[model samples]
Target chain A: MAVPTTRTARRGRPGYDLESLLRIAVKLFNERGYDGTSMEDLSRKLGITKSAIYHHVSSKQELLRLAVGRALDGLFAVVEEARTVPGRAIDQLEFLVRGSVTVLADRLPFVTLLLRVRGNTKVERDALAKRREFDHIVSALVEQAAIDGDIRADIDPATTARLLFGMVNSLVEWYRPRRDDDLHTIADTIATIAFEGIRLPGGE
Target chain B: MAVPTTRTARRGRPGYDLESLLRIAVKLFNERGYDGTSMEDLSRKLGITKSAIYHHVSSKQELLRLAVGRALDGLFAVVEEARTVPGRAIDQLEFLVRGSVTVLADRLPFVTLLLRVRGNTKVERDALAKRREFDHIVSALVEQAAIDGDIRADIDPATTARLLFGMVNSLVEWYRPRRDDDLHTIADTIATIAFEGIRLPGGE
Candidate 1:
């Protein structure tokens, strides 16, 4: 029943463009994994031929590059956005943290694929390098935040940054956006829990 | 270069037991991913024949089962150990958090595989089921702790548990056993940062 509905929906669609093709490809990649997936799998999933998939993207690696690149672009943009401009380093860090949750929520599947890439291919290796760069940028913010005495000073800034973002990144594991609890609510919850430990003010 | 050293090291040893084989398999699984790895790959990496590999473990799935089962056993043992016995719910929660980090560090590869399994196979599904059970137990502790006024009440206990473990679990991503920093040190840092927000006690 659902399969027929999906088939009919795709049939009703006018044409497959690069964006739409990439979306379908990413879904397959995430489901079966990048290595496990092939152009034949994408074609089968999309109810199209291998040539149709190639017409949009030269190779499976090209689809992976585009998909993960979309996620990476969103993340790097968050760091550069005027709103994320440096105020206090801690404030900037908080903005990045919150902005990241929003990005993860908005581009969940793409970011999920981005996080799971194992550096098995050139495209994957590039994605991992970019990810490390992002982490380094955030870690620097953490160092500045500690130096400014905005956050705790005892823990190493690099470790602090990784753990903080780890809490944020874990969202990709289970966070599902719903109508009642929107992305903002999820992001705010994460920011609060991360910065303000789960303890109430004045509680021991 | 390293391959001969590994083979020589293994051959110098007398007993080739199940535990040792699982460790090698888990390392391969983590490196190439479970689905991406094959028995031939394991044999090549180990410098052993397929028959020799099968002599220890009947199949790759059996190896995966034993590897993940070892990790799950370690974790479950932490929960059941007299040291983690009933106490202030908050204290119990703290013990579990710290113990989990130790387990992660001690059984890094196996736990890494456990965490990454996507329930694609029967062995993977079983591992995921046990993982959910462990999460449920920890979440219950969080709930009890919140009820006892030990932790904050704003966020759901289950979500708090996930995020807390998320921070701990992220250790597998970058943590390497170093001479200066030991597992206890890593565990202590995670506990302090987690329970006491990175912000100093008096700071905003």
Candidate 2:
């Protein structure tokens, strides 16, 4: 795979690093469904030959595995960190929520790809398995929180966890990062709404 | 375009009515994206000739148009009903949340298709525009509710509205309908989480 001299790297991505290559691959996979996108498509988009792409990543499946791995890694890191928080399950849950919003925001493309995985192949199936594991951890937290009288016991903990993360996971869809947007404020709002409720005290 | 006598509609879809055809088409579009799905594929799945399938809907784009229309119309209908609720803005917002959930659950496939549109074509662009209009209406309700001192005014209303609906919209991804699952219980859970929140009263 002869490295193209000039025209291929017109986007200033000439001599692409693995990180840059992975980012572009994830973006393409998200825009075009994993099944819909082809190796030729990725090569063309990257302005490199197919062999050049294969040099960095063994296969398209490897590309997907790497991208979703980055996202899952970010999420699990938060879960691991929250596990050490010194408080009740509610406290850990809040920490997870804040940490997750930061992960989704920081690694939006990778997380977006992770969220869209549909288990079409071995790589996707692994990602889905990891995701279920993550969900189980969250549900356990919610269940423990409910038992401690910290969270509402009226709702099933599993259902409660789904809705809680549903709101936070939604950032990939509509949350465009703006210059002035505050990540802490965003996390604060999620915690506020999730814990304190959005309706004024007397109004509810 | 004479219809074949036998094996085409192996799924018991022989002689598909427009409703049945629309449902199957939406399902296929969801499974294999609209661009990836061919009319021949639909005809093969329906046990009809391509021309016979075309006799019902003018084009695949029409199928997409109709599919997304069903989903958008369901959402708009909820908005209209919410408008008729003679109460505070918070009340209307709650109504919108519940109604939207019903729409999503009842028409899961259509709503799923609606959420995945990426504005690649005229039909998609139109659907995206309608979606924005729907978001604006919901944001207005949130803003008004905040001004009324019913909703906490600290967070931006638009941001709040996005997160609220994000939770509802997520039903398409994970929510599976079972005969024993009560719809009201689900709606109550969403309303409770969005308005009253998940934490116990004194937990904060």
Best model number under lDDT: 2
Pairs of colliding residues, candidate 1: none
Q: Of the candidates shown, which would achieve the greatest DockQ relative to the real structure?
A: 2
Residue-level lDDT of model 1, residues B101-189, one tens digit each, is: 98898888888899899998899999999999989988898798788888877777777788888899998888887646667767776
Q: Tell me the docking grade of candidate 2.
A: medium
Where does candidate 1 stray beyond 4 Å? A1-14, A82-86, A178-181, A200-204, B1-15, B82-86, B178-181, B201-204
Candidate 2 Cα outliers beyond 4 Å, as residue runs: A1-13, B1-13
Deviation from native of the Cα of residue A45 in model 1, angstroms: 2.4
i-RMSD of model 2 (Å, 1 decimal): 1.3
Interface RMSD of each: 2.0, 1.3
Candidate 1 residues A52-96, lDDT tens each?
666677788889999999899999988897244757887888889
DockQ of each: 0.45, 0.70
